[model samples]
Target: MAKNTGASKFRKVNVDEYDEENFQDNEDADVGVVGPNENEVSNFLNQSKNVEALKAVLQNPPQGCKDKRLKDKVVQVVVRVLSAFKTSDIEKGVNALDSQSLDTLMKYIYRGFEFPSEGSSATLLSWHEKVYAKGGSGCIIRVLTDRKTL
Candidate 1:
């Protein structure tokens, strides 16, 4: 009869040596401090005294912003400014945007879809149509594939 040895079955496991929670989640700690300030855009809109300036400010969104909450505030402001524009102005606004601004606008358009309000969808759709016509599918791909969210 062969003797059964527990030594072969069990190797030492230093539980303290291995970290059970080694994974690190993306930090949003700097969200409040970093990214575009809501007041800055709002103030600029006031100072410029023109809705067209909204497009300008949006064109230069805070570089490397990954904060969704901060971006959402800006989008809300954008949608409001967009809503204020006349139908004729919408086309002009879309036309005025450069490729970079178009992509940013597309991102806002998609984000606006998440919280549909009265008549907001129609406005977003109008903007989307104009942007898609101008930028084509590539613009959307860039927005979708980007790791740094607006």
Candidate 2:
């Protein structure tokens, strides 16, 4: 038998010797779901003061709702934009909303509240209060009472 020693028995790995071509991209990458279009939309919503852009996005969200990742991205963008709205801006936006837009807004509110860590729920609630204060209670009440909303 060989004499005992305190040195490690295992050989050291030389990372530089690994073949790069054989390595595939990680399937579980931490990259988020937001695509370029979603990024553009979120950027426009964040950087632009134009309410019309927001109105357009709210009126017609990107249509891949079947994909949970896409749906989450859409919801995230909407909530971020809505959370940035001022009371007057929200009141004006609420007033300009037709029935369809109102439904969309209600969806946003529901989704916003679904994930509290996003922090948009508080903004939505505050906006609701502002709507009531602006005498738009009927609109909010109609949305809240809608069977499709919950």
Clash number by candidate, in order: 0, 0
Per-prediction RMSD in angstroms?
Answer: 6.4, 15.4
Q: Which stretches of candidate 2 lie over 4 Å from their true place?
A: 1-40, 62-64, 129-150
TM-score for each candidate, following the candidate numbering: 0.66, 0.55
Instruction: Estimate, for each residue in 53-135, the C-alpha lDDT of model 1 and write its tens digit.
Output: 55645755543566567666777777876676667677777787789888888887888888789999998898888889999
Global lDDT of each model?
A: 0.72, 0.62
The best candidate in terms of lDDT: 1
lDDT per residue (tens digit) for residues 32-145 in model 2? 432335555566665765365557557554333345666676677777777767756777766776666666666667767766766666788975565455445566676667
